[model samples]
Target chain A: MQLTGGQILCESLIREGVDVVFGLPGGAILPLYGTLPQYKDRIRHILVRHEQGAAMAADGYARATGKVGVCWATSGPGATNLVTGLACSSMDSVPIVAITGQVARPTIGKDAFQEIDVTGVTLPITKHNYLVMHASEIARTIREAFYIASSGRPGVVLVDIPRDVFQEKAEFGEYPTTVDLPGYKPVLDGNISQILRAARLIKEAQRPVVLAGHGVLLSRAMDELREFAEKTQTPVITTLLGLSGFPQTHYLSLGMPGMHGVAWASLALDEADLIIGLGARFDDRVTGDLKRFAPNAKIIHVDVDPSEIGKSVATAVPIVGDLKRVLKQLIANVEPAIHVEWMAHLDQLRREHPSLYIRPTEKLLPQYVIREISEVTDGRAVIVTGVGQHQMWTALHYTFKEPYTMITSGGLGAMGFEVPAAMGAQVGVPDRVVWSIAGDGGFQMTMSELATIAENNIPVKFAIINNNFLGMVRQWQEFFYNREYSASGYTKNPDFVKLAEAFGILGLRVTERSQVRDAIIKAMEWAGPVVVDFVVEEEENVYPMIPAGTSVDQLIEEPQMVEERR
Target chain B: MPKGPASHTIVALVQDRPGVLNRVASMFRRRGYNIVSLSVGHSEQPGFSRMTFVVNGDDHTIEQVRNQLDRLIDVVKVSDLSDENVVARELALIKVQATPYNRSEIIQLVDIFRANIVDVSPDSLIIEVTGDEDKVDSLLQLLKSFGVRELMRTGRVAMLRGANAYPGTPSANGNQ
Candidate 1:
C-alpha cells in the first residue's frame, strides 16, 4: 500500500511490536509528528522534556525489557542531544534505536537551518547507521536499525530520515526487510577444547571459585550458573554488575567482589586456586592490581565477546561463547566434587566478617534504609540505583534474586540514572514494584523525570538517601585528600519531599532512624509514584575500599580519620 | 630496512561518502603504511566505493598493513592484491621538458610504452600512460633522463584474473 515515509515508519514499528516511542517534535520532524496521529492506537508516543532524557528513557526501557527501545529526535541540536545517552547505551550494551529527522535532501550540504550530520556524529557510538533519502527505504532502514540494535552484543543504532523523504509517498512494507549480515556472526557454542581444559582445571583445583558478571545476567544464564556452582561446590564471587546473578542469600554466593566489594568475597577471590570467570570483565575496580588479583588462580574465562576474554587478565583457558551455553556444558561434563575444607574456610571467613550494617538507634544509616526497603518490597521489586555511596549500600544490603531486577548503569556508572531508569522499568513491567534509590546529588540531576512518573501514574517508589552532599566524592575527599572539603558539602538544597509534592506525587520524609521502616512502608502504600527522603549521615563512607594499586588483602577495614582536617 | 626495494598492494571497499577517502589515507599515514600510489572510485554498487593502495613493504610489512586496515571502521573489506590478483594498473601523467633535440626521442619512448601525448606546450609535453604498476614506474624512470617537469600518478587498481577469488566475492563463499 502507498504511504508516506513517516507513515511507513510508524506502521513498521507497529509490525515490529513496538508499543511506545519517546520523542519531542521539531521543525525537521514535523512530517513524522504529523503522521504519528494515524498510528496513535498501536503506538504510544511519550513527549520527554529533553532529547537526552528521551534517549536515556529508551535505554532504561531496553535494559528492563530486553527489547530494542526506540527514541526519536529532530535535526541539529536535538540529534546532537542524544549523543550522551547513545554513548551510555553503547558502553553498557543496551539495545536502543534512535531515529532523527534531517533537513531535506536538497539542503543537506548547504548548511540548511537546523541541519547537522547526525549520521556522521553518531557513527562511532552506534552499531550501524543509515541516512534514508528515499521514501521507500524508510521501513527497511528502521527495520535494519532495530535488528542491528537488538542483535549480538547489543548497542544503539541510528536511522536519519530527511524531512522531504518523510513527506514523500512510497509503497510501504513490513519491517525487517531481510536478515542477511554475512560479517556479523555471533559465536554461541562454546569451544569444546577450552571447555574441556576448564573442566580439567576445575577437577584439579583444591579451592576454586566462580566469578560471575553482568554477562551472565545478559545471557539469562542464572540457572546454569547456579547448577554449575552447586555441581562443583564452588563459591561464587560476583562483581557489582553481577550482583543479581546468584541469590544473595545463597550459602555459596560470596557477594560483590571489587574495590568496594565485600571483604570476604575479595579475600576469597585472592586465595582461590582456580578462578572460573563467567561474563564479567575484570575492571580495575575488581582487580585493584592486575598482578595481585587472583595471583595464584588458574583462570578460566568465558564471555560472549571474544575481545574481553584476555583483554584485562590472562586466562589459562579462554572460552568465547554465550556464558549460559558454556556454563551448561561445564556442568554436564564435569563430575560433582565437594570442597569440604574450602567451604569450611569460607564459612569461617563469613562468620568472622559478615556484611555488617550498624542500625543506630538515633541516626539513620543508608544501609538500614535499604534493608528496610528491601524487606518492605518483599524482594520482588526492581531496584535501580544512582552511583556512589548509596549505590554501594544497595548493592550490599539488598538481595536481588532475579536478573534484570537490579537495572542500574553499571558499566557507565552514570549518576542520575536511577529515577528515569526506574520510570522506564515501571513502564515496561507495570505490575512489578519499581524503586529508584538515589543519593542526594544524583536525585537532583534528573529529578525532572519525576514528572514522568506523575504523568504516567507509574507506581515507582523513589528513595533518596539525602546526605546533604555529594556523598561519594565527599567520601573520597575525606579519605584520600585529607578532608580538604573542596565543594563536597551541600549546605543549601531544596526539600525533596516538597519537590516530589510539587510534581503531583506523594511525598514522605524520615529523619529519625526509627521512622525509616514506617516511612518506606507508607511510600510503597501510595497508589501512584511516591518519594521518600531519608536524611542519612553526611560523612558515612563505603568501607572495604581496596586503595589504588593495592591487593584485595590490603583493603582498609574501616574508614580512616582524616590525618589533617582542613 | 632492506635497502633494496619492497612493495605491496592492498584493495579496500568503503562507504561512498565525502571525507572517507581522506580518513582512509590519513589512517594509513598515521599507522605508518607507506603509500606508493592510491586510487579511489565508485564501486559495483551505487552507495559503495573502492580504493586500491600500493605500499613499499615486505611480507611482514604487508601483514601489518592488512591488520591496520582491518581495524579501521570505514574499511569494509581489505585484500592484498600483490599475492591474489593479476590485473594491476596505474595511470600516470608526466610532463617532460621537450627541447627540439629530445622531442622526437621522447615521442619514440612514449610510443614504445604505448603512451599518448595528451598535451604539448612549446617547452614541455605531457604524456599519459596507463599500465601495470611496474610498467608505469619503468616509464617514469625512463622519462626522468629528459628532465621531467611535472608528474601525477594514480595508485594501482587491481582485479583478479579468471576469478580465482576475492575475499568478499559471492563465489568465495559459494553461497550465491
Candidate 2:
C-alpha cells in the first residue's frame, strides 16, 4: 500500500505491537503529528511537557512493562533535550526507541531552523542510531531500531528522520519479521563448560553471595534467581536498580549493597568467598575501592553483554549469555547445597546493624515517610524515585516484594526522573498504584510534568521529600567538605502543594510525624494525580555509607548518639 | 597475554558507512584506550571496510578494546591479529633531502630495502616502502640521517596464514 512515511511509521508500530508512545510535537515534526490522528485509536500518544520527560516516560514504561518504549521529538533542542534520558536508559540498559524529526534533506547541512546532528549526538548513548535519508527506509529503520533496542543487552536507540521524508509517500510493505544484522547477535545460551565451572564453584563455595542487578528485572529472571539462591543456599545482595528484582522480605535477600546500601549486605559481600555476579556490573558505588573490594572472593560474572564481563573486576568465570537462560542452565547443572555457617554469620551482622532502623525524630523523617508509603501500599505499588537521599531511603525502607515494582534512575541518577517516569509507569500499568517519591530538589527539576499528569489524570501519587536542602550533597559536604553548604540549601522554594494545585491536581502537605500515613492514604484515595509535600528533617543523612573511592572498612554507620526507632 | 603494556593489533570488518570511524574513534577516546595507529580502506567484500588498529594496552585492556569495538553495530567482525600466525605489512612514504652527493647512496639504500622512489624533486625524493613495522621503522631511521623531510605510514594491516580466517568468513573452520 502506498503511504506517507508517518503512516508507515504508525503502521509499522502497530505491526510491532506498540500500543502507546510518549512524545511531543514541534515545527519540524508537524507532518508526523499531523498524521497521528488517523492512528489515534490504534496508537495512544502521550504528550509530555519536555522532550526529556517524553524520553524518560518511555524509559519508565519500558522498565515497568518489559517492552521497548517508544518516544518522539522534533530536531535541535527537542532532540538535545533527550540526551539525559537516553544516557540514563543506556547506562541502566532500558530498552527505548526514540524517533526525532529533522529538518528536510536539503536543509540538513545548511543549518536550517531546528536542524541538528541528532544521530551524531546520541551515537555513544544509544545502542545504535539511524538517520533516515529516504521515506522508504522509515518502516525498516524503525523495525531495526526496535529490534536493536529490545534485543541483547537492551538500550536506547534513536532514529532521526528528515521532515520531508516523513511527508513523502512510499510503498509500504510487510514489516520485516527479522533484521539481517550480522553484528547484532546476542548470546542467549551460556557456554556449557562455563556453566559447569560456575556450578562447581557454587558447590565448593563456603560463603557465596548472589549479586542481583537490573539484568534480573530486564531478563525477568527473578524466579530463576530465587531458585538459584535457594538451591545453592546463597544470600542475594541487590544493587540499587536491582531493588525489586528479588523479594526483599525473602530470608535469602540481603537487600541492596552499595554506598548507601544496607550495612550487613555490604559486609556480607566484603566477607564472601565467592560472588556470583548476575547481570550486575561492579560499579564504583557498589565496589568502593577495587583493591579492597571483596579481596577474598572470586567473581563469576554472568552478563548478556560480553563487554561488561571484565570491564571493572577480574572475572574468575565469565558467562556471556542472557541471565534467565544462564540461570536455568546453572540451576539444572548445580546440586542443592547449604551454607549454614554463612547464613548464621550474615544474620549476626544483620542483628548487629539493622538496615531498616529509623531513629525516632521530633521532625518528620524521609525514611519514616517512605516506610509509611510502603505500609500504605503494602509494598504492592510501583514505587519510582528521583535520585537523592530519598531514593536511597526508599530502597532501604520500602519492602519490594515483586519484580519491576521499584523503578528509579540508578546509573545516571538524573534528579528529575520521578515525575515523568511515574506517569509512564502508571500509563504502562494502569491498574497498579504508582508512587513517585522525589526529593525537593529533584521534584523541582521536572515538576513541569505535573501539568501533563493532571491533564491525563494519570493518578500518580507524588511524594516530595522536602528537606530544604539537597540532602545527599549536604551530607557529603558535612562529612567531607566541612559543611560549607555551597548553594545546596534552598531558601526560597515554591510551595510544592501549591504548584500541584495550580496544575489542577489535589495537593497535600504533611509536616508532623503523625500526619505522614494519613497524607499518603489521602493521595492514594484521590481519583486524580496528588502531590504530597512531606516536610522532613532538614539535616538528615542516609547512613551505613561507604564514602566513594573508600574501602568497606571505612563504612559510616549511624551515630551512636541516635538510638534506633521502634 | 602480556603482563605489561604492549602494542596489540586488532582488525575489524565493518559496514562502509558514514560515522563508522567516528564511532570507533569515540569509543577509543571515551574508554581511554590509546590507539597507536589506525588505517581503514575498502575490503574484498563490497560495502565493507577493513580497519586495522594498533593499540597500546595489556591483555585485559586489549580484550576490552576488542569487545567494545565488536559491540558497535556497524562492525561486522573484530579479530585480534596480535597472537595469530599472520602476515602484517605497512606502507610508508618517506621524503628524504637528497643532496647530489648523497643521491646515489640513498638510491642504493632504497634498492636494498626493496623500496621505490615514487617521487623525485630537485632537493628531495619520496621513497615508498611496504613491509612490517620494524622494516619500515629501520628504513625511516636510516633515511633520517640523510635528513628526512616528511614521513607518512599506513598502519599495520594483517591477514592470517594460508586459509586461516575470521569466523563467519567463507574459508573459516574448513568451510570451502
Candidate 3:
C-alpha cells in the first residue's frame, strides 16, 4: 500500500517500539502532526512547552527505561533550542532520537521562513545524523537512526525531513529488519590476551581500586562489576554519573571521586597501586591534576568505545569491548584475593575526614534537605538534578542501591535539566517515585515546564533548593575572588511556592530545618506533582573540593576563614 | 619519528554520499586534531570514495583521529599508512615568473627535477611536478629564485607497496 511520508513516519516509529515521544508542533511539522490521530493508540505524543524540554525529556526517558527515547521539533528555532539538550545527551552517552522538520526541498537554501541547517548544527554533538532526501528512505533511515543511537556507546542522533516529503507518497511494506552500514559495527568481545593481562594486574596488585563509570549502568554490567569487586575484595569508587551502578551502602563502595568528590575516595585513588577503570573516562574533573592523578597506579581501562580508552589517562592494559562481557572474562580468569590492609587504610582516611559529616546548625542547610529526602525515600527514588551545589549535594548525600536510580547532566553540566528530565523519568517508569532536585539558580531556568507537568499530571516531586544565589559560584568567589558576590546573588526572586500554586500544583515552603522532612513527606504523599521550596542557607558550600586543576592532596576540607557578613 | 609530535598518514574508504567530507572535516576540527594535508577522490568501488589525510600528532592523537574517523557512519574503513612501506606521491603546479636572463636556468632546473612545463606565457612558466612532498618542495625552492608567481599542490596520495592490502582478486595491480 502507498502511504504518505507522515504515515510512514508514524508506522516506522511504531515498528521501532516507540510508545511515547516528547515534542511540540509548528508549521513545518503540521503535516506529521495531522497524521498522529491515526496511530494515537500506539503512540503517545506529549506536548512540551519548549524544544529543549522535549530533548531532555527524551534523554531522561532513555536513562530511566534503558530504551531508545524519541523527540520531535519543527524547523529553525525549534531545532536550535534542542542544541543544549543534544549536547547534554551526547556528553552523557544517552540514546535519544531527535526528529526535526525542514523546509520543502525547493525552498531549502532560499532562506525560507523556518528553515535551519539542523544536521549541520548538530554534527559535533551527535553520534550521527542524516537529512532525509526522499520519503521512500524514511523507514530505513529511522531504523538506522535508532540502531546507531542505542548500539554500542549510546548517544544522540537526529533525522531531518523536509516538509514537502511528509506529504509525498511512498509504497510501504515491512520496515527494514537489518542495518547495512559496514562501518557501524560495535565490538562486543574483548581480546582474550588483554583480559588475561588485566587479570594478571589484578592478581598482583596489593592496593587496587575499582573506578566504575556510567558505562556500567548503560551496559547493564552492575552484576558483573559487583561480582568482580567482591571476588577481588576491591573497594569501588563510582564517578558522579556512575552513582547507582554500584551499591553505595556496600562496604566496598566509596561514594564519588573527583574535584568535588569525597575526600577519602580521592585519597584512596591517590595511594592505589592498581586502578581498574570500568566504562569511565578519567575526565579532568575526575582526575583533578592529570600529572599527579593515580601516580602510583597502573591503570587497566575497559570500555566499549575505543576512542574513550586512554583519551585522558594512560592505560597499562586497554580492553576494548562491552563492559559486561569484559568483566565476565576477567572474573573467569582472575583469582580471588583479599586486601585487608588496603581496606583498613581507606577506613582510616574516611575516619580522619568523615565523608558525610553535617555541622549542627539551626539554619536550613541544603545538605540537610538532601539528606532528609534520601532518608524519606529510603534511597529508592529515582533522583534527577540540575547542575550546581544541589547536584553535588545530591551526589554526595543520596545513598543509591539500585542501577538507573540517579540521572543528571554529567558531562555537559547543563542547568535547567532536572524539571523535564524528571517528568520524562516519571513517564518512562510510572511505578517508580521520581524527584527533581534543583538549585535556585538552575530551577528558574526551566521552571516554564511546570505548566507541562501540570497538564500531563506527570507525578514528579520537585524540590527547589532555594538558596537565593548561585551557591557554587558564590562559594568560588568567597574562596578566590574575595567575596565580590557580583551577579551570582538573586536579589529579586519570585516565590516558588506561589509560582507552583499559580500553575495549579500543590505547593509548600520549608524555611526552618525542622520543616524540610515534613515538606518532603507531604510532597511524596501527594499523588500528583508537588513543589517544595527549600529555603536553604545562602552561604553554604560543597566541601572537600580539589580546586579546579589542583591535586587531591590540596583538597579543601572546610572553610579556612570566616568572613564577617550579615 | 621522535617522541614528540610527528606526521602520520591515514586513508579512509567512505560512502560516496553528500556531506561525508563535511563530517570528516568537522570531526577533526571539533577534536582539535591538526591536519597537515588532505586529498579525496572516487575509489575503485563505484559507491565509495577514498580519502587520504596527513595528520600531525603523537601516537595517542593519531589513534584518536583514526578511531574518530572510523566512528563516522559513512566511513567504511580507516588505516594508518604512516609506518607501512608504501608509495606516496604529491603533485604540484608551479607558475614561476621567467625573464630572458633566468629562463634558460629555470628550464635546466626543471629538467633536472623531471618536471614538465604544462603552460607558458611570455614572462611565466607553469611547471608540473609529480613526486613526494620533499621533491615538490625542492623544485619549488629552486624556482623561487626566478620569482615563483603562484603554486598549487595536491596533497599526498599513497598505496601499500605489496599486494596484501588490496581489495578484490589478488595481484589485481600486478604487483605480486
Candidate 4:
C-alpha cells in the first residue's frame, strides 16, 4: 500500500498488536497526529499533560503488562524530557519504545528551531536506535524498534522520524517485521552437567539458601523456585529488586536481604553454606562489605545474562540460562533433601530478630497507612510507589500475593515515578484498582500528572505520605551527617487536597491517624482520580541500615540510638 | 603458570582506509602479539575490511588480549581461529637474494605449496600463498631459509561456517 510515513507507522504499530499509546502531540509530530484520528478505534491514545508523564506512563504500562510500551514526542525539549523516564526504564530493564518527531530533513544539522540530536543523546541509554530520513523506512524502523525493545535483556529503543518524512508519500510494503540478531541469542537451556553439579551442591550442603531476584519474576518461574525451596526445605532470601519473587507470608520466605533489609535475613545470608543466586545481581548495596558477604557460602549463580554470572561474586556453579527453564530442569533432575535442622535454625533467628512494625498512634504512621490501604483494597489492586521512605514502607508493609502487582522504580529509584506509572497501570488494566503510594517530596515532582488523570478520567487512587521533608535523605543526614538538616525539610508546601481539587479531581486530607482509613475510602470512592494526603510523623527512618563499607552484620537497628545515644 | 609457545589467531574487522593495516601492525608491535602469519582482505560488504593474524602465546592469554582488542569498538568481532571454523590465507612478497643454484629450489618449493609468483623482478619473487595458518607458517619458514629481504603478508579474514548471519539483523526478532 502506498501511504504517508505517518500512516505507515500507525499501520505497523497496529500489526505489532499495540492497543494503547501514551503521548502528547506537538508541531513536529503534527503529521503523525493527523493520521491518528483514522486509527483512533484501534489505538487508544492517552494524552498526558507533559512529555515526561507520557514516557513514565509508557514505563508503567510496560512494567505491568510485560509488553513494549510505546510513547511519542516531538523534537528538542520534547525528546529531551523523555530522557529521565527512558533512563529509568533502561536501568529497570523495562521494554519501552520511544518515537520522537524531528524537524524537516532540510532543516536538520542547520541548528533548526526546536531541533536536538536526540539519537546521539539516547545512544548510551537505548538498546538500539534509528533515524528515518526516508519515508519508506518508517514501517521497517518501527517494527525493528519494537523488536529490539522487547528482546534479550530488554531496554528502550528509539526511532527519530523527521517531519518532512512524515509528510512525504512513499511505497510502503509490509516488510518482514522481525529482528534477526545473530550475536544476541539469550541462552534458555542450561548445561545438564552444570545443573547436576549445582543440585549436588544443594543436596550436600548443611545450610543452603536460595537467593532469588527479579529474574525469577521476569522468567515467570516463581512456581518452580517455590517448589525447589519447599522440596529441599531451604530458606529463601530476596534482594530488593526480588521482593515479589516469593510471598512474604511463606514459611521459608526471608524478605529483602540487604541494607534496610531485616537483620535476620541478612544474617541468614551470612550463615548459609551454599548460596543459590537466581537472576539477581550482587549490587554493592545488597553485598555490604563484599569481602564478608556470604563468606561461608559456595555461590551458584544462574542468570540469563552471562555477563552478570561472575561479574561481582565468583560462582562455583555458573548456569547461564533462563531462570525459569533452569529451575524447572533442576527440579526434575535433583531429589529433594530434608534440611530440618537448617529450618529450625532460621526459625529461631526469625523469632529473635523479627520485622518489627510500630502501630499507628494519634499521628498517622506511613506503614499503617500502606497496610490499611492494602487491606481495604483486598490485596488485589496494582500498587505503584515512588522512591524513599514511602517506597520502603510499601515494600516492607504491603503484601503483594501476585507477581507484577507491585510496580516501583526499583533499579533507578527515580522520584515522581509512582503517580504517572499508576496512571499508566490504570490505563493498562482499567477495571482493576490502581494505587500510587508516594512521598510528599517525590509526589510534588510530577504531581502535574494529576491533570493527566483528571483529563483522562483515570480512576487511580493516590496515597501521599506527607511528611514535610525528603525523608530518605533526611534519614541519611540525621544518622551520617551529624543531624545537620540542610534543605531536606520542606517547611512550606502547597496543600495537596487543594491542589487536587484545583485539578478538578476529588481530594481528601487526613491529619490524624484515626482518619486514615476513612480518607482512603472516600478517595477510592471518587468517580475519577483522587489524591489522599496523610500527614505522617516527621524524621521517621527506615531501619536495619548497613552503614557504608560495613558488613551486613554491622547494621544500625535503631537510627536514633546510633545517631544520638551511641 | 608457565607460558608455552601456542599458536594464536587474531581476526579483526576494520574500517577500510589507507594505512589501517600499518596502524594495526604497529599496535601489535607495541602490545607484543608475536605475529607468525597475517592476512587481510575486503569483506563481502563494501568499504569494510577484515584482517586475521596468527600469533604464538597461551590460548587463554591470547583470548584475553583479543577481548581487550574487541573493546576498541572499531574492531567489530574477534574470534580465536584455533577453536573456530575458519579459512586463513596470506600474501608474502619475499625479495630473497636468489642465485642460480637457489632459484630452482625456491621455485620448486613455491610450486609445491601452490604459491604464485605475482611479480618476478629478476632479483626477487613476490609469492602469494593462500591456505590455513600452518601452511602459511610453513611457507614463511621455508622462505626464511632463502635469506629473504622484504616480506609483506596479508592478515586472515574469516566468516563462520554454514551461514552468513550478521548480529542485530532485522530478522533477529524471533524471541520477541
**Which candidate leads in DockQ?**
2
DockQ of 2: 0.44
Runs in model 1 deviating more than 4 A are: A174-177, A352-361, A548-550, A561-566, B1-176
lDDT of 3 by residue, B1-176 (tens): 42568888888999988799999999988899988999999999899999999998887788788778867889888878887889999999999999888888988998999999998889999999999999999999878888988999999998989777733211110111
Candidate 2 iRMSD, 1 decimal: 6.0
Worst 10-residue lDDT window, candidate 2 chain A: A557-566
Tens-digit lDDT track for model 4 on A1-566? 78999988888899888999989888889999999999999999998878889899999898778788999899998999999899888877788999999999999889899899887777656766678888887877777777767755577988999998988999977666565443345567877888988889988999998888878777778899999898888888887667777877788888877877887788888998999998888887778888888999999999766556555686789887788899999998778788888889888987876355564366667878999998887776788999988888887778766677778887788999988899998888888888899889989989998988898899999999989999999988887788888899998989998999999988888888788888878777777898898888887777767877788757776645485544
lDDT (C-alpha) at residue B142 in model 3? 78
Provide interface RMSD per model, one decimal.
8.1, 6.0, 9.0, 9.6
**lDDT accuracy of residue A96 in candidate 1:** 89
Model 4 residue A47 lDDT score: 87
Predicted structure 2: lDDT: 0.89
Alpha-carbon runs more than 4 Å astray in model 4: A175-177, A359-361, A564-566, B1-176
**lDDT for position A135 in model 3:** 91
Instruction: List, residue by residue over A231-289, the lDDT tens digit for candidate 3.
Output: 99999999999999999999999889988899889988999999999999898989988
Q: Which pairs, if any, clash in model 1? A: B37-B155, B38-B155
Better-scoring candidate (lDDT), 3 or 4:
3
Give the Å shift of residue A314 in candidate 4.
1.0
Query: What CAPRI class is candidate 1?
Result: incorrect
Give the docking tier of candidate 4.
incorrect
Ranking by DockQ, best first?
2, 3, 1, 4
